[model samples]
Target: MLNAFRARFWDLALGSAMTVLFALSGTAVALPLAVAQLLPLFWRRRFPAAALLIVGSATAAHTVLGMARAIGFFPATIALYTAATHGSPRVKWVLCPAVGVAMAAASAVRHGPVEGLLMAIVTVTVAWLAGMERSEHLRQRMERAAAEDRERLARRVHDSLARTVTVMLLQTEALRATTPLDSAAEQRIDTVLGAGRSALAEVREALAAAGSGPALGPRLEMLRGAGLRISGHPPARLPAPLQDITDRLITEAATNALRHDGPGTLLTITTVPGDGTLTVRLTTEPGGSASGSQRAGGGFGLVSLTADIHGYGGELTFGSRHPAGWQLEATFPALVPGHD
Candidate 1:
């Protein structure tokens, strides 16, 4: 609404009326310069710096002529505000003061030094301050709106994509067990499954980057119900990255365990904090079927999990435990409060 009143044609019409009023008030001697000063108000919003320069030049011309100094002040004030509010930081900090000082010197030369300089200083200062305040308020409001948008997007990823990936994992595991497959078919299945799982982990990591994500507890429970027998009590407060990394580690370890072993296999998940390091360990019974499984590479999810852990100065080690099972252990440094 305010901008509409300051629109190009509207400003021109208003300026014309102001010019006619000044002429009627017996200040018509500087009519041409005053008119030139006010005319550029038409493009104040689109080209604030140029408008300020034009208006400032005209104001200086009329003030030096000692004919219509007051007539130009109104348009010059409006142009100053436009420059401060819409100009880039360099223009706002530098060009605005330069234009104001030039106009102030003209005003001081025309009127008495005390009154003319004070009027010029106060008018330009107040207008610039008002414009700067408004700019800062608008900037803060936009930042808040952007943060809310990111959180909303994170929630959507959690509710929709996370669940879809969970279902995909369960379906893939079940299909691998029931269906008989040749070597090529088994390799193809592993490739598809690993790709899907890696994509899901990447999505989770991205959402967590925005400081919002699904909790680890619910995801752990879902995995437990799917196939693997899991047991662990995670801490109440963990960094979002660590929680996400741990969740991926558990999912990948469980998937690999279920793929290799029979239904009787027991997978144990444990979280332990000691000596400034939080460790998550997954143990599974090893030595299952090798008929069509165990291709060239192991699980691709392991590679993804290793990168995630290493990013936080953590380490992940996996190999056969003492007598019967495989153990995958990830150790992360405990983060101080407010650091994460």
Candidate 2:
């Protein structure tokens, strides 16, 4: 209660301070009107044009005032527009002041006709800059994220693919070295060859999908389609957070289910979203013995999951089920619009 009050108080205090500062130092306009241009930044992305209009309307008001006052803020507007668009650190200040003066003179000459044109120009410039910045930022971020994903995939290939291929090659060598009429060895070779070829195909697909994003839906679907009817729990959908943290966990979980339990094991990821948090539960039956460097060492995917969740200001936990089975669980705070 105290912390919440403190937070609210700080919010009020900051807002009030900003309001006072803008009123005193700004064009002596009210808070809502003067700072109105920035309202678009807080709007939902789906309503982009509306957001642009809001910012532009505010810009129009500001530009008109600055023109009448002969105060040079047109360059600042251009800079704001540019910063918001190209998101570049430095905006060309060259013509902004000149533009402002000209706009003011034009406004006077036309008795407010040019005011609309100047406002439109400023609005368009800011909108274009914001959009360009967003696009470039998203593209760069996706590229980095894709690169990380591919790196993780390359590791998986190095681990599982190399091991599977080696087994295949060794099995082939053993089969060749077997004497004539080696029925048992011949049958083993058939199994090994089949497994190897399947593994090779899977590896190739993984490599292809590395830099690319995952196919939609559950990871187990990939395993089940590959002829592993391994089951320990039930059907599971990934948490939204895990959607951003796939590859390693997906591979590890599937590997454990397939290798540890062989086949016919049920695995389920249970999700419970409530009370400003999202909970994830992964349950595996008797076959839930966790493998991999971290899990095998009794180190925590739960801990990591918790850290990840808490990074978003949430929590996570893991434990044995009531009656039986091993369970992994995570809880994350759901993002609330305009709450930030």
Candidate 3:
């Protein structure tokens, strides 16, 4: 109620002020007509088309009566702008021409036909241009809002679902190690762990789709307590698009080590500067000697890592170790690798 009163007050205050100025300037002689044309402006946004129709009809009537003052143009100009900003584009197109014709008819009745038509055309063009500018500003504001929303959702995913998945993987490992189970039970636990790891990967991809932000490496530090050994240089700043990708790759690799390599797996992660390349290697090995079947548990993470590396003209490779485990290596082109 207060807001409605404030809006109505502002419209009346400004409308009355314009009317008085025009009256003094000999542009408007009547107060009632000018007020009628402008009073509806208070509701312009709430009902743009209806407000415009009311103002436009009043304007047409005032012009026919030869009491049309230059000040009277203010209300119509504002009404058209409100409609353009709030109404659909089709409405903008229709109102512009209609307002122009009304102005021309009024001008023809009061002044000579040629002079009135010219003045109407100029006034209508100015209103149209002002409306277009308002619409563009509104569009830009909406886009910024949508982008902010996506970033908010991304942060929530990281804080909630992603962390939960990590906890599940860690607990699964602890359960596997402490309780001796038959082969069938062990296999079931492995399946659940694998699914949890895959969910983490999907969350990482969601972060990418949400848009870039501050380096995620800092955030990934929470996983240190989740049962995976993380050893590397403190995450470094990389090239524009590469920073987020590198952070995600590191997080995903560490997660795969903990989840898929089974209980008591050792992970060795190394990252450092090389000649024109940023080198990253993650090697995972089971605690005990691996048989032929155990050696192939590298998981599906390497496929995405390979594709992302290739996008930046980098090379990615993975191979089974001689004794046990799997080693995945990727080198990204960097003009200055070690430099922050």
Candidate 4:
């Protein structure tokens, strides 16, 4: 909304300046034509092709009517640049050249063929090329930023969670060696050891994949073995960062559920893929009395997860479900940042 307001404000200011310039130049008769040539620029970024067509048409009319050439040329060139920069892929390449040619023909009416062609080449063609270059530069910069973010996330997971899991694995090993226990208790400890080992391996894989590894299938199987009543199938081949976030979200949410709601908690995980977006939902019902209480607002894990999700232009929401349960849902764009 703020961006739209600023664009409109810029267009208004440009239009006003052009109108004033015409009025002061003793071409007051062309003020109306100038307004027509410049008004469509207000929507130039939002509706680039349509805006370019309207602005180009009005500028052509303005030139043919013997109006101030500056008034028509300036806004037309701006529209051409915008069309090249932000227009839909289906129309951008086609519309820009067509509009450039039309505007050049109009210029010829006043400036003659040779000068008009030079003006179009120098202004319109240059503007289009500049816009394309700017667009490509912005895309490369955004991709680099996204890659950096993924690397940072991978480092955090390696430094924090991986170390913690290592400690847990060592502790479980020491307990089994030093303490006497019945067969059943030994089996439970063995289960913990297996889970810790699996987690450590998964963490290593995540680091190797730059936070985008970890097969969801095996993780879900492990969770099921841990007695979580799981449902829903995982989507295959999610984008790198998205798959990473999804894995982390599920791990964090399930850990909280098992800690707070205890073993045998019914967990329903669903993934819904939509037009350029993916939504994941996890719902957990308390299996019994609380094993532990979570800190207010779901503790640091959820807080951190929320920040990560938002960083990817996604949303993460969680709250208590009615009739005693917890729910978490995340929705994000399916594509990586700067990707098509």
Ranking by TM-score: 4, 1, 3, 2
What does candidate 1's lDDT look like per residue over 1-340, in tens digits? 2334445456668777777767676654566777778678876765678888888888877777875555557788888877776666666798889988988888888786787888888888998887677656555554455467568878999899988988898899889999999999999889989988998998888787765444556665665675556655554455445565676677677667666654445678788764335788888764344221333344678887887677666789887655556788898754311111
> Where does candidate 1 clash, by residue pair?
none
Better of 2 and 4 by TM-score: 4
TM-scores, all candidates, are 0.55, 0.43, 0.54, 0.62
- lDDT tens per residue, model 2, 1-340: 3544554565456445544555555553444655654434433122333443454455445555552222223323433433333221212132223333444444444345455456544644564456456545544554565578567868878787678797777768675677564788778777777888787777777777666456534666777775444433432343333455433343445555555554554566555644223455666554334231223322454355455555544455555555544455555433311222
Residue-level lDDT tens digits of model 3 in 78-126: 8877676656544677865687678667767776667666776677678
Off by over 4 Å in 2: 1-21, 31-111, 123-127, 175-182, 215-340
Pairs with backbone N, CA or C atoms under 3 Å apart (clashes), candidate 4 = none
How do the residues 262-340 of candidate 4 rate in per-residue lDDT, one tens digit apiece?
Answer: 7788778899764346789998887765433433477888898898888766789998876677889998754432221
Overall lDDT per candidate, in order of appearance: 0.70, 0.48, 0.67, 0.73
Better of 3 and 4 by lDDT: 4
Alpha-carbon lDDT of model 1: 0.70
Better of 1 and 4 by lDDT: 4
Better of 1 and 2 by TM-score: 1
lDDT of 2 at 189: 71
